[model samples]
Target: MRPVIPYLVSAGLFGLGVFGLLRRRNAVLLLMAVELMLNAVNLLLVTADTTVRAALPHSGQVFALFVIVLAAAEVGVGLAIVLRLFRLRADIDVDAIALTGPDATVALAATSPSLTSPTCGTPSATPGAAQ
Candidate 1:
């Protein structure tokens, strides 16, 4: 049996998942998209395993197993982070987490003298001043 059709379907599903992940702002939707991508990969791996059973043995299946384990761990950690962000900010928008903004950069530069000065050992006379 030709495996091209199944591979194409899996590719289409993966593409859809990528689209959803990029376009959706909700954390749950993003997680669902990630799960879709993982399933698409698993489908392709299984299809490859079936087609190359004689030559490749069970390598593809083993790889699929590893991917499933990794996906589970990723979902767990990703959901935890999402929950924490939602609790702190009351929103799940990925764009809002700007840790390196202009204000933050300026504040860090002002506070850290070693970061702005060329002389690493010499301390400035003014407290918190760059050397």
Candidate 2:
């Protein structure tokens, strides 16, 4: 019932969320850290609604609800992206994720002459056309 308890709790939650986000390497744990951050904000909003600002009664609660909804959508899309990443790479460690494979661009450049070729998009020979 202490007046400062809510503030302390919210601050602790936020701090833990930030720590988890920075420390975790797995994709799912990273997502959970983001959820922790969202929940911390929600708790702060509700605390302010009930105690600090009597003028605006339920506004903070309403905003908290919106945050919850946004967090839900974020989880859905985030998980799907993580699942796709897992399918492609067979691992979910964020440190292993890269914008491109180590040899992907180099292999493409080596095989495709289009970079310097005059007729890039057109194939050099038509298989069934008359010679």
Candidate 3:
């Protein structure tokens, strides 16, 4: 069918975005992957609108418009959060924030000591504690 090409391309783009989102640790790269996923969905909606018989009164176009608005909002909020994080830590590595390892968790906890307690200091003898 004539619409198959666009649908396949959209699917591929969505898959690529998913892969990038999962594999990349950079905040900017993650945002780009999100954009790619949004574009892919837009393309699929437009293609469906054009190919389907008895056209459905431009509902797809309306949906696409809402998606664009949502994407813009997402980008704005996401960038603001990323900027704040960068200001605080000076880096944009998503993996760094995960802090899955015990060492990482302890190090983060030590660095961010409680405001009301001076005794909440760095771990003195924990093995593998981050420097």
Candidate 4:
């Protein structure tokens, strides 16, 4: 049970996670890659708890539990976003998505005319501006 072995395993897992994140384009796959990275972190934390002499016993395990909780929450939100994107656009290709492109700007303006030129009919809400 060499300490270096666990460290190397954790590093390898993290590397694979990073590779998946970079190579995958589907939103669901991206979330899975992030979960892989989080699991690697949990493995590292548990290994540290076993190997290191800490003042608080099992602190690393506690941190790992927290990470697990955080990962669950992250997966929930990420899946919700992916599902919403799929419903709206009928696809979840992350590479094809653009939140701030010209089309997005135009769509926003089309949806909310008040956000466009204030002269469209809605009074500008800016304080001390020329009416």
- Estimated TM-score for each candidate: 0.74, 0.75, 0.76, 0.78
Note the Cα lDDT for every prediction shown.
0.83, 0.82, 0.82, 0.84
lDDT for each residue of candidate 3 in 6-56, tens digit (9 for 90 to 100): 999999999999999999999989999999999999999888877773768
Candidate 1 pairs with clashing backbones? none
**What RMSD does each model have against the real structure?**
7.2, 7.2, 5.1, 7.6
Instruction: Give the poorly placed runs of model 3, Cα more than 4 Å off.
Output: 53-55, 98-131
Q: Taking the tens digit of each residue's C-alpha lDDT, what string does model 4 give over 1-131?
A: 67899899999999999999999999999999999999999999999999884667999999999999999999999999999888666788887665885777554454554566324545335578776
Name the regions of candidate 4 deviating beyond 4 angstroms: 105-131
lDDT of 1: 0.83
Ranking by TM-score: 4, 3, 2, 1
What would you estimate as the lDDT of candidate 2?
0.82
> Which model is ahead, 1 or 4, in terms of lDDT?
4
Q: Of the candidates shown, which would achieve the greatest TM-score relative to the real structure? A: 4
lDDT of 3 at 83: 98
